[model samples]
Target: MVVEAKNTTSPHNMNQVDVNSDDRRDEQVPLLLQYWQAVSRYRIGIACIVLGTIALGIIVTLLMTPYYTATSRIEINRNQDKVTNVEGLEAEDVGQNLEFYQTQYALLEARSLADRVVRSENLATGDAFFQTFNVDPDENGIISGSDSRQSSEDRRRRFELAIRLLLDNVSISPVRGSSLVDVSFRSPDPQLSASIANAWVAQFVDSNLDRRFDSTIDARKFLEERLAQLRARLEDSERRLVRYADNKEIVTLSTTRDAEGSTVGGDTLISSNLAALNKALTDATADRIAAQAQADQNGLNKDAIENPAINGMRQKRAEIASEYAKILVQFEPEYPTAKALERQISDLDESIEKEELRMRTGALTRYSEALKRERNLQNQVAQLKSKFSGERQDTIQYNIFQREVDTNRQLYNGLLQRYKEIGVAGVGSNNIAVVDPALAPEQPSSPRILLNMALAMLMGLGLAGAYVVVSEQIDQTIKDPSDLKNRLNLAPLGSVPDMRKDDIISMLQDKKSVAWEAYISIQTSLSFLTSHGAPRSFLMTSTRPNEGKSTSAFALAAVLSSTNRKVLLIDGDMRNPSLHQMIDQKNVQGLSNYLSGDDDIDNLIQKMPDQGFWVMTAGPIPPNAAELLSSPRIKKLFDHLEEKFDCVIVDAPPVLGLADIPLLANAVEGVIYTIEAGGVKVRGIESALRRVRSSHATIFGAIITKVKSSGTGYGYGYDYQYSYGQQDPLPAPSA
Candidate 1:
């Protein structure tokens, strides 16, 4: 073994240098390569596709069924009873159709009509229809699959059930604003459907008429009772009012005439009395005022003047003054002053008072005048009012009797008219006649065959979509190159692409196929990814075992050898050694024995016969694989291999939980991580790669494994909708 100087970190800045010995585990090149190799090695999946397609086709063919159907139409109209040929019959009874249409529709639901349909059609005979339905008839003539009824009643019920089922299948609706109703039905048998529909119409007309007549009879009876009650009430009201008027002496209670007459009479009487009293009071007051003034001036009592005493004195003074005026004409004032005043004055006053005795009798005379006139007028008014009282009472009684007679006559006439009408049998009715009847359907209204089937297909597609959604949610798998490109943000190299094993093998054996030419093209991509042909040591591995790292590396080495490069293949997986098994070199001392210093360099080197490829296998399973790969000796081996070969390929152990690959990977030039299809948990692959990175290894981009011919571009045959045996033959590769 050549002793190569180790790269060192000098802590003391002296030649006494200590080395790291690559404490980091090498990248698991073998597992990554295995995964990628397994990806391309998907023979089992093609078999699965062919098998699944066949199975799916068979299942779909067996489960699907064919269906068939029948259809018909009728228009319904409302019937008019007491139909008048007169023009504007409809306009005359406006809004009458609205009421009749609704009521007729309700009457169509009558149980009696339903019964008639059942009885007439013998709809209870579904049992007898077994033969027509292709049902096996029993010894008792009942259908084989149907349950037997217990009695006639049960039979009728069963019949009704069948009718209702058929009826539900029928549809009846008015067509727009027209009086026409469209009746339709759907059934398996077209003729039976039409017959039942026509029968339903006939039955509907009969049933409608029966119901109308019955309703009108009841309504007429009720109206008769109402008319009787109203007549009696009106008569009783008239009689009571009449008797009340007769008893109250409320003659006519003429608010207008009587009110005016009473108003005028009351005003005249009140005014006359008030005026006479006012005049008497005024006269008496004037007389008293004069007497008071006189008494005050002459110093005599005013009441005495008001009475006859004052009047007499005033009269005596008047006579004396007159006599003095005569005497003073002849005599002088001094001589007559005594004679004219004193002589016979008392006798003269007596004569004068006696002369006007009637006028000066008393003040009672003035007061008595008003009293007498008021009394006389009052008596006259009393006499006039009394005279009218009896006449008013008589008028009231007569009016009462006349009103009673009038009311009774009116009520009697009303009753008599009604009685006469009834006697003559003049029947009246408020019931609206059916202008149109609800007819039975001529065809089934539901389960429209083509439409329903199309709907069913739609439902099936929806169900399929839901199933895919739910299934996709449950499945966990690495999907495609897009998953890497889009989700993982990794650069995607072109695919290695799956091909038929037969074509691949033939192309490889003959060295003459378009596919074989494509393999050469992959070599060009490899050169591009390998960075301008820089000779570098590579460690290959996947997340776990059985990925095709070894095969890909072998193939890559072979392809490189085709280009005349010296490609050395080293099996670095100490845990499981399969490459050595592939190369058929077992128990031949190589890496493990050489690392323990069991053999020298020239003695340990092995060679392959066919390709003259240098092949190295894991010499023995080591307990401390991680430590051994990270030892100084392994670094020496890498240095030697780097000098000896154009490209060194070390097939390493899986990086998952194993340090052997990561330790070895640090010594390599680059690492290629491999991934398997629908295998290796994503996090697990990431973790494995992380381990490779932490091992201080440089990495080539990842390779996605398991490119199935059916699932990828290589499966181009599927694009042609292949019937059977239509595959194109393989041709030779271009020179």
Candidate 2:
């Protein structure tokens, strides 16, 4: 049996081969190359899109209306007010606050400013600006003669409508880090654009100056009224203080220092008196202390006892004692003279004691008198302090009145100064000035022709690229041979370009053509499929009918016969045989008749004219074609044909859902699988291959039939070169 043994390698090994092949493909081929190839394939459609979009862009650019923009520059002074050299005048930097500059920009585009510009330009009557909005000249604009007599309400409405239109056309932007702003207006008329921009700047400056003047005037008037009120308040405060003091008899006195170095005024008169009485009480206390000390020392001090009465009594006692001593020395005893002397001395001693007692009593009396005087001074000091407390209450009210007077005076002075400064500032010139007036523009700002066309081309290419990618994603048809080898591991033997004809005879007859060249290459590849020489008996089949399987069979047989080899082309599809039609042979006595044992192989085979190939057409439609192909007798028939012919090519039926091809495949040395390019999906090829593989049939390789010639870079290139008179040597197809 020439058929190779079934693939004994495990499913795991086969899967690994597939996986490694996929990994190698991913590593070798870049994503960009794949995209480039796709773009190259579908470039015609993409070019159509780009050209169409560019044409549309050109038309739109021609139809668009042009607009001209005019701009005016103005400078704002943050310290404008400080330019004047007034003493109290200081400038405010409105630009220092974020919201301030934002507000200024807003004001530049304000409705009021717009209204002023409109009136100044007299754009409310029969102007292009108002007419663009379809506003009636009679109702919305103040026409010169007739409509001028419109009502006040009507005039105000027209003014408002014009202002809205002006604001819509105006734009304001501030220059960064500078006190400058750009005011721009866009209009169809260049002159109107410039005029409107200049008018807006002028109106903004006027409005700013008017606001400053009004604020100053209002401040002056308010200050005048405040100054009058403060003066009256000051006078009333002073008058109230004076009247209250007089009514309460609370006289204000000058502050003075007393002997104690403490401040003394009429406010402290009671306190001063109390201090004086305290000093007297201190003195009296000291006197009483000294007198008491003297009384305490009366028994111990000789000077204390030596008063006038005490000293005289002591002298009389001393004389009597001397006389008694003289009588004692003379008298015998109990004498009258001695007794009288002793009695006299005792009386003198009694009189001395009485004198000392009376002197001590006088010291006590002086001490008591000093204490009584100290008590009297303390009582007087307490009464004076009580009286001073009552007077302090009155002083509190007086202090309140004085503070009010001071506050009123200070406020009145501040207001008077501000009133003067504002009066000076109100006469100052406007700080905001136009730096550059708007001039009429020479060119339109919109509907750029070249730029629009460029953008449109870019957009068109983007859309077209997206369409190609999406179509490629949804389309499952095989585009080229590389996808088959990489995705399905099935290398195509050769690619047969679309023949543009239903008859295979025309393609076979036309040598040096793409279809003829493709099959020649296929025949060459068929020689290398087997290591010995070539596959002797191979089955030709496809995933479905009408995919060029029968045509390929006849062509391969013809090419094989050209190599001086006897070839036998058999139509194995008895159910729907097509080989007879391709070769213009009769099917009366063919494979079916031979298989049914009615006719011999020699009577069943037909010979082609001048072509060294034999054809065995399907004789009749059989009821069990698959069963007939599966019988042991089919193998006998193949073996007998192999001995007779150099190459036996069987045209088998489509493989999917049929038992015919797989049974035939099992007997042949190899199976030649054919798929239609851009016709069958990879899934269909895989399913048909699976069917052949299950029968243990060896797949020689695959062939992609009817590939589009453009961008395929397959056998079509060689045909093109040869047809154009180029004799380049083409390489043989690989196994």
- Taken over the whole model, the C-alpha lDDT of each candidate is 0.54, 0.74
Which has the greatest TM-score? 2
Clashes of each: 45, 0
Per-residue alpha-carbon lDDT of candidate 2 for residues 1-735, written as tens digits (9 for 90 to 100): 444442332243334434433443453335666677678778999999999999999999999878789999998775565455553333454546777777788888778888778778887654466655445645525534345566777667767778877878888888888888988988777888898899889899889878877788777788899999999998998899789878877665455555533333344455566668878878988987887787778744544555666677677878878887777788854788888877888887787777667777887787788778878887887887787788778777766776676678778887887887787673556668789999999998777899999999998999899989997888787766556676677645666766643544564666665557778877766665555456788888998888888888888887888889999999999989887777666667688877777637898888897566888899888788877776788888988888898889999999888888878887777788888877778788888888888888777667887765554555345456434452553333221
Using lDDT, give the best candidate's number: 2
Q: Candidate 1 — which residues are off by over 4 angstroms?
A: 1-163, 171-195, 204-475, 486-490, 497-535, 580-587, 598-613, 620-624, 678-687, 690-699, 717-735
Tens digits of per-residue lDDT for model 1, 1-735: 221111121122111111111111121224444444333444354345445545554555445432112222333344333342322112335435587666555545555666787788776665643333333333454454345545567565566666565556555565577655444444446565566556666677666455545654665576577667767766776677567655753434322224212211112233344456556556655655554354344323344446675566677688777877777788776775747475667666666556445433333454455456656665655665665555556555455555555555555565555444433231232233234333344544444455555555555545544544454455344444434544443433323334333344344433334433444544554454432343357777888886666655665565666677887888888778776766666747677877777648666667765654677777788787777776788877888888888888888778887878767866776676666655676777777777876755555555655554344433332233211242565442221
TM-score of 1: 0.45
- Per-model TM values vs. the true structure: 0.45, 0.55
Candidate 2 residue-wise lDDT at 227: 94
